[model samples]
Target: MPRPAEAALLSTSLIPTDNSTYEALPLVDSESLQALITHEALNASALELFAIANASVKEYGHPTRVIGSGGHYKTLGWIEKQLKNMSDYYTYEKQEFKALNGMVFNHSLSVNGVKVLDEKPFQLTPAAHVYWADLVVIDNLGCEDIDYAPLNASLSTNTVALIKRGECPFGNKSSLAGKWGASAALIYDPESDEIITGTLGTPTNTTVGTLGISKTLAESLIAQKNAGVPLKINMFIAAYVGFIKTKNIIATTIHGDQDNIVALGAHSDSVEAGPGINDDGSGTISLLNVAAQLTNFKINNAVRFAWWAAEEEGLLGSNFYAYNLTALENSKIRLFMDYDMMASPNFEYQVYNGSNELNPPGSEELKQLYIDYYESKGLPWVLIPFDGRSDYVGFIETGIPAGGIAAGAEGKNSQNGEVLDKCYHALCDDVTNLNWDAFLTNTQLIAHSVATYANSLEGFPLREPPKVASSADVPYKFNLHGNFYIM
Candidate 1:
């Protein structure tokens, strides 16, 4: 069982943020490392993870673990307690940062005085209160600046800009609307009736507020504009945009080669929907289970396990950590492995591409490790682009070679042709959203992969001197928002 929050304070009791504390455990022979991970142990860990998650919902009176919320703080406590109780082999630190978070108190939209579905506000956007406004439709996929060139949007400051969700960040579309002098940007899913949710990457990315709507409503507005009818909307959104204090819990083994670190991370916060069980409860627990089991043996390279916050808002926690690292500090980490959504209900073994263009170098080798592991077990695995969908965005843009695994969320299940996790970012993504068989399998992979590198980085290339790249250089795959999707 997870301990109470008060006891979790011990996780804050050790290690300096600058990588100081070091205690060495005798390194075990590389050949005997396989015995470190056991199925019984993994099953036990899974139960603990689910219990902690479900219990938080009951204790906090809300399912979401969004930043600064009770549920989010509770998960941080659980993570701390889990690591601090692990035989004193770990020394932990709380890396603090200022997280920019936005909240929508209430939002609703109406067209021609007819009620419609409430528009969900994207994170980090300003509030909106428009009594009335004419509608302007962005005709093409507003990905690039040129796409918005032909748009005949209104010049009035009171006009509403409507655009379709297409090959770009919703922020880019909204930002374009801000350029054309619109009061608000309304993005709609031209392909699906289901409404969407997202973040604008950072605070004040646009002057006007951004909200999402559905195809049925959007098409009606477009048709009205195409015809000779006037379209006006009354939209109201009460929101707050500001910074919040949050911390990342990074626990390092007290014993091992501190120079060549094997860092593994998963974001600790969730979307404003559901308990986030499969989206990241699985990812969080995978690290916990592996961290605990690995203590049975010794490691050659030090292992670091991190719980990142504000990943839903953008990769805030990990980005802060990566950005603040000195060049020398960046070189110590030989590999970075991110675990996210390890147990999607409709599961597939998806490994991020080692050859992913976003990866710095030595990433392809990391990709092959998972591929080889899966092939050896006769498990079918597919390739996914190492997009900026998760916390790895921080490590890679910092020029650290990184790779990891995911069970997938929005992608279609090859067999049935359905969304991988139908409850993705929805209120239904609870403990029951997990596929146990797949969970166990991936948990084993997490343990095996971590232990393999910890024992020795035999072929895992040493990280090159980081030639840091700008954030724009990284191809962050949009369709992004929350945890499983892009940003």
Candidate 2:
């Protein structure tokens, strides 16, 4: 192998004004680079990541890493605690932003005065309290005013609309209830027996607080109505809606070249459905573990490791950081690499093709590095498009050459036609959700790439002069298959 440059360590939450100390980066010798990349460290960290993502699974029955929840805060605290040990070589900072979040604190319901324990609360809606409300089953999705015509009973403030989930956005359902003067709405999944959990997208001016119920609950209530029974129901939903403060955790190495930089990031937040271990816990933990091990050696370019928040809500945290960067600050960043879902249970080795029109010149080079690394190891790899599916989008759109890697998630593996991660975005995405081999190999690749870049930016293209950062302005939302999109 031709001798490569020395590797750098991760650092920097925000770039400072006038980082004019641009100097030459020295290559890290091959031996030092090899020393920084180790199997033992990656394996050890994998064990810890599984435990953390699954930490509350047995006790609470789901992950605590969902944003705005107490558990999510604790998980972030745990990361900070880990970084404390490496205080001697690195520093960390936080990026705070206003994020619309919801927490379903408590929910309860009763049928004919008998309490029903099976229920789930809707997010981003206000609290609901009703007593002996008239139960009216909206026959069709309340998307249009004509749909509510089938509700024979005259609507009143005490009306509770029990609607099925389908065809329209949940926000539309809740808003329609308001138009009908229904004080509260209960949505249920007609197909699945599983209790529904979701957000109303954004804060709705409508006073119709929404909650989700299982098919059984809806069926039981509907059956009672069919039998000419006047069903009096009582419901309570203790919830919080509107904006909450959450932050991105950024760390930088005080050891490497500060001006010429390499950045790697992964989101730290999980969806309300589960811990998101394989979806992104794999990425988050890998960066943390690598950042810890990186302190042992020094390199040419400075490396910045960011644990982004609200990526599940449309890459908000990462975009905020990228979009705000001044042209001068953007020039210092040689490459920005993103790693997400590196350990999908049903796996494939995939790298961003970086073919987006706006991606700076070095994108192909970044993709080639991963291609070359896997090839050298006699491993198979595939190319994925720079589809703006993850955190790398903002930087790449702003004229930065960005590339990322993912084992796979939701996307199918052509080799066997298996879903790359069946547990993706589900509660099952916990301790057992990862492909250990993929996890280990990808992380090792991160260490190798970081080390090489830190040692020298030799074969990489010069940073494109920074332009105004931009991304799709559409709302970020969760699709039916549990994937997020800019649609």
Candidate 3:
């Protein structure tokens, strides 16, 4: 989508794949407001930005974007300097990662006479108490009214509880079941379809060493009970606390009405296992591209651009910012739009379902804005549940209306197809692993959304005080080696 420069004005000395070519690429003039908001202009910017990231990876390594690392800090600093060159409205904030040191669990269960306990180091419930116990399946889904009576009437002493996932907070389910005499708890998808992993809300938070299970396993155990077969399972968990320091980069327009702000964000850090180019490089670069173009135009309502850190580590960076805001500061934020992954190799256009599921007041309007854009373009899109899988987690938690788009992540390309973004969270998610078409398409949408709200917050509702909720209520399903569970 990049426009070719006039050959006479361009030098033939630089190689297109070289970093020098990226440095030599033309950027929109700071006063060119007309060029700034145009979709083609932003897409062109994104192409060059991607070149910069590819260069960063080449200079560093596959795991180059880990938070607080020298490579990550230096790269982020370079970006900050670029923003400063365009405008003087940027700052950085540092936060401790508050390390969740270690979690080890020994689980044992029998399915159809097959003993399936491999002694894996399962993720622990935050601050969960150390314990070992036999397990029992609760009669009611583990969402509400979890009393010991049903658990007691179903199983004997020291029996762990297996409850379906829904309704109440994850920690709440374990806490309530523990109150009723269960030594530990296991929460699984009600449909028994996926593997789920999540935080227990906070580092110091405690619960009954709860474990998330696959819907398949839970259903099997339930069927065994129904067939008058005995179901005995054992689970043990141990955990400790620790911290890592990270930083967040925030930029705001100095010329707009600062009282009513529109914020957009994307996580900049990658996962521990990979470079996370598609997982987040896509989102990070898209916003950076938008931010660079926006410097060309003045706005009515102030717009803030945030490059969050440690989002893959359970939305830590955004959580710190939102949680630390004063009521007045929070209210100034009309809405928060999050962009995580935008160019999965096996791509699908996904718009966050802000209106119905995570209805943070004005979220529906934001959702419709995206829907209308895709519809107008004659491109099909699916509404994805606004689960707290990325930085938007913190924004929605703060009751700040939020919405955004994603190409695809580790999910399937279709019901019968392979995993979307085959290299997701893998080392292969490098410079060559993106869908350029999807990337440009989504980048244009980012420009549209940011420009729309920046010019006017008309239909975008104002914010009220936020009541943050635990993210465990919305389960993320994962299929590991064909074993599906919530993550």
- lDDT winner: 1
Residues 1-487 of candidate 1 have per-residue lDDT tens digits of 1122322122344544442222344455433444565556655655655455554465345567777777788788888877768635788888777777766677888888987764677766688888778777776876666665434434555788788886767667777777766778788887777677777756444557878887887887788888979887888888888877888889888778899888999888877666787778788877887787677666778999999988887787887777667787788988899998988989899998867454667788889989998899899999987656778876777778889999988768887888898888777787778888778778788877787888778866667676454545543323443332542
Tens digit of lDDT per residue, candidate 3, span 142-202?
A: 6455345667675467677877766555656776677677767777867425454444433
Candidate with better lDDT, 2 vs 3: 2
Model 3 lDDT on a 0 to 1 scale: 0.62
The TM-score-based order of candidates, best leading, equals 1, 2, 3
Where does candidate 1 have its weakest 10-residue lDDT segment? 1-10
Order of quality (lDDT): 1, 2, 3
TM-score per prediction, in order, is 0.86, 0.70, 0.64
After superposition, the stretches of candidate 3 with alpha carbons farther than 4 Å from their true spots are 1-133, 145-150, 154-156, 203-206, 226-238, 242-247, 254-260, 268-281, 293-301, 309-320, 326-334, 344-348, 352-365, 384-401, 407-436, 455-487
lDDT of 2 by residue, 259-330 (tens): 888998988888766777776888887888778767666566788888888777657778777776768777
Model 2 scores a C-alpha lDDT of: 0.73
Give the Cα lDDT of each candidate. Answer: 0.74, 0.73, 0.62
